[model samples]
Target: MENNMTNKLPKISEAELEIMKVLWSNSPQTANEIIEELEDTMDWKPKTIRTLINRLVQKEAVSYHQDKGRMYAYFPLVSQENYLQVETKSLLQRFCGAAFKPLLVNFLKEEKLSSEDINELKRILDEKTEENKRKDR
Candidate 1:
């Protein structure tokens, strides 16, 4: 929810994000295995994938382990939900700023949400309102 998260986050670059996508989809893979498998989908060579893997490791986003002289695998340190929240909050803060009411008003005015979806949103909003009120004290 703060700029520090965006600015100092251990995030991978665009190229490395591809490897992360694979890691996120199927976690805990070795460098060689990821490189070999990624060739079918990505234009990058094995070395390229390896470089990305190294970069991801350095970023602390992905963790690795070794066994019997073989690097076993890696996994994402940050959950998808957390990552999504960070990105979405950044966008909202940048575009909507402190004018969330108007932002919501515009979205509600333009988008035709289903009744069920609206009800679900209302429920979520109620929970958030309760949380805000509790924090206000």
Candidate 2:
């Protein structure tokens, strides 16, 4: 993990994640812009969206800067990749006894993986295996 990802990140709720997704797709959007983008998909009121934004700001997961006279543009402080890493690690620790193989096997057995997906997983595992071999030398 990078240095920025090493620190504990503030927990983000599912609703808050919706706002973050919009910001992640395109950064520094005003509250109104975010609300507009989500309006078609979400039934939330503008005020409710604003409240979620406020919570994210308070959590330090999002920050804003004055874009024009009164409007502020908001962006995510946390990267999507970093957040996923933390969440994946937490899930593994909580339910998988911190073991990766069992979880991976379970997913492989349960999920309907396409040929491309299986090939990709094989390639990744092969690369990791070679890297570990070199390190052990």
Best by lDDT: 2
User: lDDT of each model, Cα atoms only?
Assistant: 0.78, 0.92
Residue 106, model 2: Cα distance from true site in angstroms: 3.3
Per-model TM against the reference: 0.68, 0.82
lDDT of 1 by residue, 43-122 (tens): 78888888888788888878887778765678877666566767666779999888878888898999999999899999
The parts of candidate 1 lying over 4 Å away from their true place are 1-8, 99-123, 132-137
TM-score of 1: 0.68
> Alpha-carbon error at 128 in model 1, in Å?
1.1
Candidate 2 stretches greater than 4 Å from native = 1-4, 109-123
Residues 63-124 of candidate 2: C-alpha lDDT, one tens digit per residue: 99996578999999999988888888888889878588988888899999999999999999
Clashing pairs in 1: none
Clashing pairs in 2: none
> Model 1, poorest ten-residue lDDT window?
3-12
